[model samples]
Target: MAPGVGGAITGAAAGKFFSWLLESERARPPRVFVSFDFDNDQQLKHLLIGQTKRQNLPFSVVDGSLKEAAPEPRWKEAALKEIRRCDVVVVLVGRYTYKAPGVLAEIAMARSEGKPVVQLIGSRSLGYTRVKGAGKVLAWTQDNLTKLFGND
Candidate 1:
């Protein structure tokens, strides 16, 4: 076999070998699925949402006319489906709001799905408890998250 192909096969074998070693800890840390909008909340939502996109990991966000004056229940279904598919759910909490009721529902659904949760706060507004299974809640500024995630 050519050297390149030989190296490729060897690397694949090594990868598979290492993958098997971590099979027992599959439930730890977990895959993260994030939810938010770009234009709607801007800062908080944008920060976490932006970092997720930059990471190139598998994640989904609310899309389409869900931002309409009156949202359809189907939007909730779609969002929950994404939340259900992930092992972790990260939400962005922002200001000038009572909080996004829909996103909150998504978090609850993630809990129902047995996914750990994480949140990055975009504002200083207080008066909420971290979700029970959430891993970490960071006071992340939108710009800082963008830079830290290397999306800046």
Candidate 2:
């Protein structure tokens, strides 16, 4: 093959590959609502979100972090709005999760909105206390996440 023709073929192949990547990203699963105790589970939340992004996972977080400056009602409303937009909710159940009213309320909102709930136990020894409408209580693992939201 002529050198110019070979170069043209390679360029076209690269373009097609990148186009497919973009389309795959756009076709990923709906945003996920993450419910957790902001004070206690923030690190775990960040770790999970970071890992998903680092590995190019097929899910995006709905940013349920409440502004501490906002009033309680405002925070609740904001969280509910996010939950309504999400396809599924993942409750990060840390040791203090049961004591967090906001986390519990977020889970309730997800349930009321008919969003599927997955309770991710942050600590293996903590023992899972099933969230009201959670369909599964899974340990925090990339494989589990992939199982719930298949790789795109």
Candidate 3:
């Protein structure tokens, strides 16, 4: 090997090195798209949004969640666009989440886009239902959230 030639990463090696750096343990915080039963779970969504401002959370909630009670036509299209830009979709499961057409539609959109979905138990009610097919409903804990978004 020529002197100093082996000292630097170049070409394919450089590309690989860069990739490794990006995928390393210190990868950027995952962008999260939050979904919830807007009719009854707005406060829960806001609670999660508040966590983004803290430095200890593992993910950053992306803006552009639908805030209106009555979505205009093509709202799903807008939702899908936002979902596509995020790393994961977090559905805040609530009492009426299953009955929330918008939440269900958002979940379907996330699934169709191949985005990972994380279901968090956002309600303390006795019969708060989970969003079907969204996988397990996990507790609202920093540890669990970190495990999901920490290195992804």
Highest lDDT against the true fold, candidate? 3
Lowest lDDT block of 10, candidate 3: 64-73
- Candidate 3 TM-score, true structure as reference: 0.81
The CA lDDT of each predicted structure is 0.56, 0.81, 0.82
Between prediction 2 and prediction 3, the one with superior lDDT is: 3
Model 1 spans with C-alpha error above 4 angstroms: 1-31, 36-40, 52-70, 96-98, 125-136, 141-152
With candidate 2 superimposed using the best TM-score fit, by how many Å does residue 47's alpha carbon deviate from the native? 0.6
Scored against the true structure, residue 61 in model 2 reaches a CA lDDT of 81
lDDT by residue (1-152, candidate 1, tens digit) is 87699899999999998898776445333445665433346555555556666765333443322444455478777667666655556665544222556566676777787876667665566544454334567776545443333311
Q: Ranking by TM-score, best first?
A: 3, 2, 1
Candidate 1 global CA lDDT score: 0.56
Backbone atom clashes (below 3 Å) for every candidate: 0, 0, 0
Q: Which candidate is the best by TM-score?
A: 3
Off by over 4 Å in 3: 1-14, 17-26, 70-72
What TM value does model 2 have?
0.74
